[model samples]
Target: MKVVVAGSSGLIGTALVAALRRDGHEVTRLVRRPANARDEFRWDPARADLDERALRGADAVVNLCGAGIGRRRWNGSYKQELRDSRIVPTDVLASAAAAAGVRTLVNASGVHYYGGDSGDRIVTETSPAGTGFLAGLCRDWEAAAQPAADAGVRTILLRSAVVLARHGGMLGMLYPLYFLGLGGRLGSGRQYVPWISLDDEVGAILFALTDDALSGPVNMVGPAPVTNAEFTRALGRALHRPTPLMVPAFALRVTVGEFADEGILHGPRAIPTALEDAGYSFRHPTIGAALAATVGRS
Candidate 1:
């Protein structure tokens, strides 16, 4: 199969491209910079422009383009960056995929589709979208891909969790602090932190690409969801360190603004109902196992 991947420079994108290549699939990177490689093509998401030929003969197009949500404190400008980064590239790709007669479009979405807080309720692919900026952002993000579906293409949304890896994503940010024994849970630490191992994250994308039965929102997370406090304890165990230090909610808000609340302190207890029913086995399913594997890799 031939695949075109946007945001091929990210942590997940980098891993996904390598995995796809390793599996004997032809992959082309849709990059923002100059196309210097044989397998790369330049695209301008800002202008909703991509060479239509890039999509021709492609079996699947995986879009992972977006601004880093936690890169800075959320203000009006950064929030607009968050929304525009996702919606623009997705609109461009969806339009291109439809016109190119692409069979599949595996777009990156998020679990924030379930809202900021779910308390005891566990969300699935079928759950109604929740309220708040992130939830609305996720809703619009997924909506931008509707053109592909309208054109009879199989469109799948990988409603991803906080991806965990030693070198990038959430774990990368936390590993150094944990190594120094200064790591702990955020806020009261009781909120669920839905997560996926980096291996599983890339693997799930591949599964979505080929799994013909799957369409619409598919939660790309572990079967078991752990609370922030539980995750803290498990991560501490993985590093053989104490995790007594805790960051209060107010302190985090002061540091990272609103994301401290919605993105960090509160999260959905989302389950990968679709993945499990599809019999997708996770490489690192448990928090303890995932953390230990992460530390070993470092």
Candidate 2:
């Protein structure tokens, strides 16, 4: 199938593009600059400019384009930036894909859509959206794809969790601390950290594109959920370090304000119900195994 992926330079996008190419699928990347002679195309979501002709023959369009949530603080301006960065690009892409008559549109959402503080309850795709900057952004982000949906395209809304890998994303921020023996549980150490390996995340995206039964919201997370303390322990074990310190939630708030309180230090248990129901298997189901595989400490 011919697939066009936005945010092709991101961690997930890089992995997905490589996997898709390895499988002999024709992949096109959407860039911000003008289209070059290469396989890359151009689209400026802020200006609502896109090369619709490049997407004319696309069988599937995966919109992974978005600003990094963990890259900065959630200030008033940054908050708007975060929201617009995801929604605007989605709106532009969806409109183009719908007009081009694309068959499948897979848009990215976050696990925060289910809210940050989930206590112990399990969340599935059918659950109602939570309230917060991220949840609101995700709600609006997914809603931007309505044009494709109305065009009878199979749209998959991926509610991805913290994607665990070695080089980029969340791991890069935590690896230094873990390697320094300062990594440990956040806050009271009881909050759930719903996570998925990088491989599983890419695989799930491919699976969703091929599976016709999948549409709407799908949680891209591991089967087994781990508490904050458990994740700290597992990561420490993976690095063979003594986790002797705990970053209290109050300290985190004092340091990074609401962002640390909401996005970084807190999360709920999100299970991939739709993926499992679609008969997709997970390579790293548990946190310990995932950490081992990621750090090459096995």
Candidate 3:
């Protein structure tokens, strides 16, 4: 199969490309920069310009293009950037795929679609989207892919969780803190965190592309859901360090500003219902295993 992946420089995108190559699939990276000798294609979602011919013969198109939520404070401009970064590219990709008659389009989404707070109420594919800026952003992101779906393309919205990888994503931000033995629970430490290993994240994306039965939203998370406190403790244990400190909610808010309140310090429990029912196996379902993998520990 020939696959075109947007956001090819991102953590998940890079991993997904390698995995696809290993499985004997020809991969094309949708890059913003100039193309090199490798399978690189040009695209600028903000400008509504892309190499449509590059997508012509592709079997699957994975849209991982988006601004990083954790990259900066959730100010008004950043929020707009986040929304634009996701929706515009997705719209372009969907339109191009529809025109090219692509078979499958796996659009990346976040668990934020489930709302910021679900309490003990477990979320599924049918769960209502929460009312917030992030939720609204996710809603539009998924909606932007309507053209591909309308074209009879198998469109899968990957609602992923906090991806745990050594090189990037959440793990990259937490590694130095953990290594310094300053790691602790965020906020009140009771929020349920839905997380997935880097390996499983890549696996799930591939599964979505291949599985004809899967469409709509699929939670790309691990089977195990842990509290913020438990996550901190597990990660500390994995690193053989003490997890006695707790960062106050107010302190986080003061340090990171609004993002500390809405994003970093708050999250809900989430599980991958579609993956489990479909018998997809996970390499690191638990936080301990995830931390071990992040630190190169068994």
Candidate 4:
């Protein structure tokens, strides 16, 4: 299959591109800079500019465009940046895919679509949209891809979890701290931490690209659910370090502001119901296995 990928420089995007190529799929990458490689094409999502050839004759277009949610303290400006960075590029790509008559449009979203602090309630693809800023952002982000679905193209909204990787992502920020024996739980450590391994994250995208039975919102997360405290312990165990510290909820608010609450202190108990129903298997089904593959390698 011929696949065109946007946001090809991100953590998930990088893995997805390599996986697609390794699996014998022809891949074209959309870059913001000038195109230099045969498989590269330049596109400007902010200006809604994409070369006519970018999506031509493509079987699928996978959009992973979004600013890092936890990259900065949440100010009014940064929040707007998060929305623009995701919704704009998604709108452009979805429109282009529709115009080019692409067969599939796999757009990126987040498990936060179900809102923060889902408590013990299990979230599925059929769950309704939740409240809060992140949920609204994800809701809008997924809505931006409506053009493709309306045009009769099979569109898949990938509501991804916090991706655990060896080098970069959530683990990247925590690896050093955990290795130094300073890792600890945030807040009361009772919030659910929706997470997935980098391998399965990439594998799920590939699976969604070809599985005709899958469409709409699919939760790309681990089958097993773990609380933040459980995650902290698992990560500590994986690194062979003692996690004896705790970051209070007030301190977290003072440190990272609003993100400390929504991004860290709260998360959904999201499960991969759609993926499992579609017969997609996970490489790291448990959090312990996921941390071993990621933190153990590091």
Give the alpha-carbon lDDT of every model: 0.91, 0.88, 0.86, 0.93
TM-scores of all predicted structures: 0.98, 0.97, 0.97, 0.98
Best-fitting candidate, scored by lDDT = 4
lDDT of 3 by residue, 127-165 (tens): 889867777888999999999999999999999898988
Between candidates 2 and 4, name the one with more favorable TM-score: 4
The sequence of per-residue lDDT tens digits that candidate 1 reaches over residues 147-258 is: 9999998999989999989898888999889889998989988899999998899988898888898888899988889999999998888888789798999999898888
* RMSD after CA superposition, every candidate: 1.2, 1.1, 1.2, 1.1
Inter-residue clash pairs, candidate 2? none
**Model 1 misplaced stretches (Cα beyond 4 Å):** none
lDDT of 2 at 16: 97
Clashing pairs in model 3, backbone N/Cα/C closer than 3 A? none
Colliding pairs, model 4: none
**lDDT, candidate 4, at 143:** 92
Model 4 scores a C-alpha lDDT of: 0.93
Error of 1 at 191 (Å): 0.4
How would you encode candidate 2's per-residue C-alpha lDDT over 119-206 as one tens digit per residue?
Answer: 7899899888888778888899989998889989899999999999999988878999899888988899988888999999999999
lDDT of 4 by residue, 1-298 (tens): 9999999999999999999989999999999998999999999998999987889999999999988999988899999999999999999998899999899999999999999856789999999888889999999999999999999999999999999997898899999999999999989999999999999999999999989999999999999999999999999999989999999999999988988878889899999999999999999999999999887745
Q: Rank the candidates by lDDT, best first.
A: 4, 1, 2, 3
